[model samples]
Target: MHVGILYSRIRRDEKLLLNELRDRGHEVEKIDVRKQQFGLDRMTTDVSELDLVIDRCLATSRSLYATEFLDSYGVTVINNPRTADICADKAKNSLALAEAGVPTPNTKVAFTTDAALEAIEEFGYPCVLKPVVGSWGRLMAKIDSRNAAEAILEHKATLGHYEHKVFYVQEFVDKPGRDIRVLATDGEPVAAMTRSSEHWLTNAAKGGKTAAFELDETALDLVETASDAVGDGLLGIDLMEVGGAGSGEYTVHEVNHTVEFKALNDSTDVDVPARVVDWLETKAAESDAAEAPIA
Candidate 1:
């Protein structure tokens, strides 16, 4: 089987998927997404022959056309096209979670700097300001005052990018020291971890430490529910404890399409890569069955 992995070199975890595919006797090609800058000639060569594509391509509006180009050719993509995963936008993620009855932090989106300021005032101080399209807690600011909110909004406006067209504001969950990441594949919760740090960001990249956690029924249900909400083959759901010492709730924070599973493998007994390989093979089998000739 010929498999294509479309991702950037900076994606350290995507290597796990590639290695697994190779181990399974698939001819895996790692297509560096940065090469598209010169042109997509690298990605455009005979993709029709490939059995599967794990699209880790971070789609900007410019790259969306390329994704559509590939999807039109019937290449099996793990999370569908960039447009299908566009709900990865934090604002949209919140809305989808709400609709799915998956508890998420109180979140709102505002267009225009004035509207953003007004939303901050409405949501009140100690809320969070985040870009709609963000990951690993990057560019996520905790605003404790009206002035700080206004300052961030003004700075964003000065940048003159479409990112400023809307701002995501959510009620701060006040997670003291820990957050949970649930890794799910095909509606099954595969691994779970609790990351602890002194800082607000508990991502492993920020020097946070990880430990294994039980995938209890609630956690499992949350993982399955969030993955379903995102409509992806595999997903990583970030859950944070909201409220204070006495009363709190576990709320969904983010749904990641392309996830890092090193910590996940270390934290659990699950074979992360093997599970992904199995999912890919099942997809391939289903495809073959669908294309079989009828008597």
Candidate 2:
């Protein structure tokens, strides 16, 4: 099968996938979004013969626009534009999960600093202030006091970007020194890991130690529900144990669309890239069969 990887830079995660696809004798096209021009009617890069296009662009804006353009050109794109649209924004991500009855962290969004402060007070101190669109725990604040909240809000208000002004305040879950990251495909678990750190943010990218985690029945159900809520594809569903590590209860905090799994591969025995490639092959075959001429 022919696969086109839409990306700006190929990281270790992308390398793993490329190696797996190549080893399996699948034709791979590395389409650099930075180097390509996407036209309304067509793109400078020809994707007509590709069986599938995977959006691996590091920038969320690039991922969304590229997939949307590719989709408009009649090419099959994994984690389709609709899914990308919902997952790229934290506000949309939370709404989708909540509307689907998935237990997520209590979140509030406000347009101005004053309104945001009201929300922060509502959730009380030690809540979190996050950028509406970001990953790897960058620009997230754990507001511990009124002073800290005022300072952060002032900073964000003056930052000038609309996204910064749109404050995303969430109730901080007192997770027991760790959080779970489950990689799933179409609501099914591919592998699970726990990211543990003394610090508040426990993302692997934020220097959290990782270990393989076995999903309990409740976790399995939440993972599936959260995946479906975000329009499942290859996703990283992040959940925090409500009370402690062994607690059966959980609150999902985020679902990532362009999910990076190199850390997951290292933390678990699962052949992460191989499993992802297996899913890709099935999707591509189904697309081909669906598009074939009728007898």
lDDT of each: 0.75, 0.94
**Which ranges of candidate 1 are over 4 A from the true structure?**
36-43, 58-66, 82-84, 243-249
Question: What is the TM-score of each predicted model, taking all chains together?
Answer: 0.89, 0.99
Local lDDT at 276 for model 1: 72
Clashes of each: 0, 0
Q: How does residue 102 of candidate 2 score in lDDT?
A: 94
lDDT of 2 at 182: 96
Tens digit of lDDT per residue, candidate 1, span 1-295? 7887877653546767777888778998776666654233434456767777776765544234455556667667766654344545777778778888999999888888898888889988899889887666778889999889889998987877797678888888888688988877766877888888999888976778998877666667777887787775667788886664223357888887666778888777888888877888888777767767987
lDDT of 2 by residue, 61-134 (tens): 99999999999998999889999999999999999999999999999999988999999999997999999999
lDDT, model 1, position 272: 81
Give per-residue lDDT, candidate 2, residue 33. 93
